[model samples]
Target: MTAKILRTRLDCVDYQEACDRIQNWAIQRNSCYVIAANVHVIMTAYWRKSYQQILNRAALVTPDGMPLVWGIRLLQNAQQTRVYGPDLMLAWCDRAAQSNLSIYLYGTTETTLVSLTRHLQQRFPSLRIAGSYAPPFRALTPVEEMADRDRIHASGASVVFVALGCPKQEEWMARQQGNLQAVMIGVGAAFGFHSGEVSQAPRWMMRFGLEWLYRLITEPQRLWKRYLINNPAFVVLFGLQLVRGLIKGQ
Candidate 1:
């Protein structure tokens, strides 16, 4: 089931169930997209009606942040744990290796893709990576987009891990829903984290919901506004929702 947190719907799923659902879809070659919803993702959806619809229409939107997990617990299910994107990608890779499901990599720079492919192969020795592509940073023309689609289709991959970051990746996946012929997952920065190009927050920090703080400290110029602005707003807005729910009950 899904719970609405600040008007954004997130799936109440643990890692195992999320992996199972993706695995099944991959095996069936389903053309769908999965979103790993974190604070930035949820806040983006909350502000943008069009983006929110894209998220609502997704095949799955896993709670990728601790706050979202807690939000789910308060709003609907008490036992919901986070299904983080990078970890989910690793888990699915392990499953795909065992099941012989080929996967394609999309987004990120060519260097990162090379490192990510190497790291994945080393971690999951039997994994089959059908192909990898790092498109130019700018928007693609219609012809260019179609060519890229053709390349992925020709690879015959059962799943495509997209690392193009939040709204862009989500929008890309939405556009390809009926055309991709594979499960496209918008994994944000999994490629960088997995490729060792980016450092992840320590486990303790993640457990305590301080990962955003760690990130803000690490990349202040790039992330300060996102964390500082969105975090407090989420708390205030969600607190109002909780209070309203309490009033309704009374």
Candidate 2:
């Protein structure tokens, strides 16, 4: 099936085709940045200037949320699946392993990294992990950033998966691209989810667009503000954007 395009400023494509298309882009063009544009990610792209720059600079941005897929359907009639971070990690891992492309996981706590590597080895038997690094909790200074850049370059990895979460990962990816010679993907929460440190919602919940509800129930303290505050507000804001677009078009 052909990937349908959204009318919005950004390109909206499905996960599988996106995977093939991006890999092709990188192969033919010799460079590309593949960004997973989920609801939270899209909201960040919508509201934040720097984040928008980082995303817009990317070679490709796939719709990573069901609502976002539906939202695109509203404007472009495209049927796109959510190219979630966790699933994308698994997808790329499977592909990279087959293609002999080395990978580096750069984020999460030490425990999470250990578990993630262990799980990847078990799940994808031939996955060649070029390297893995767990950075400090606090923000990294320029020196620290440069050191990280050097580390990735030395590893000889063709794919660097940055799991620093949201804006941090996005920021890191944008900055490290020139320094690190590889495809840098900001895969938020994928490391944790795959490592079993974080639980994913049920398929039904996800299909019905209630994954956030399930997550909120699981970890209220950490995600209450995100769900109760940001989620609804994002809907309102996006709705307003749609209305505003309609008005301008008229």
- The model with the greatest lDDT is 1
Q: Distance from true position, residue 224, model 2, in Å?
A: 1.6
Please give, for residues 154-219, the per-residue lDDT of candidate 1 as tens digits.
999989999988789999999989988999988998999999999999999999999999999999
Candidate 2, pairs of clashing residues = none
The regions of model 2 sitting more than 4 angstroms off are 1-9, 21-32, 244-250
Worst 10 residues of 2 by lDDT: 1-10
RMSD to native for every prediction? Answer: 0.8, 2.9
Candidate 2 structure quality by residue, lDDT tens digits, 1-250: 2232222244655556666764664344333466777667766666687788888788667767777777777766555567776788788788878877778899999899999999999999999898999999789999998898789778877778888878888887787765666787778888989999989999898888898898889989987876777678778877887888799999
C-alpha lDDT of candidate 1 relative to the true structure: 0.92
Q: How well does candidate 1 score on lDDT at residue 218?
A: 91
lDDT of 1 at 225: 87
| C-alpha RMSD of candidate 2 | 2.9
Candidate 1: give the clashing pairs. Answer: none
TM-scores of all candidate predictions against the true structure: 0.98, 0.89
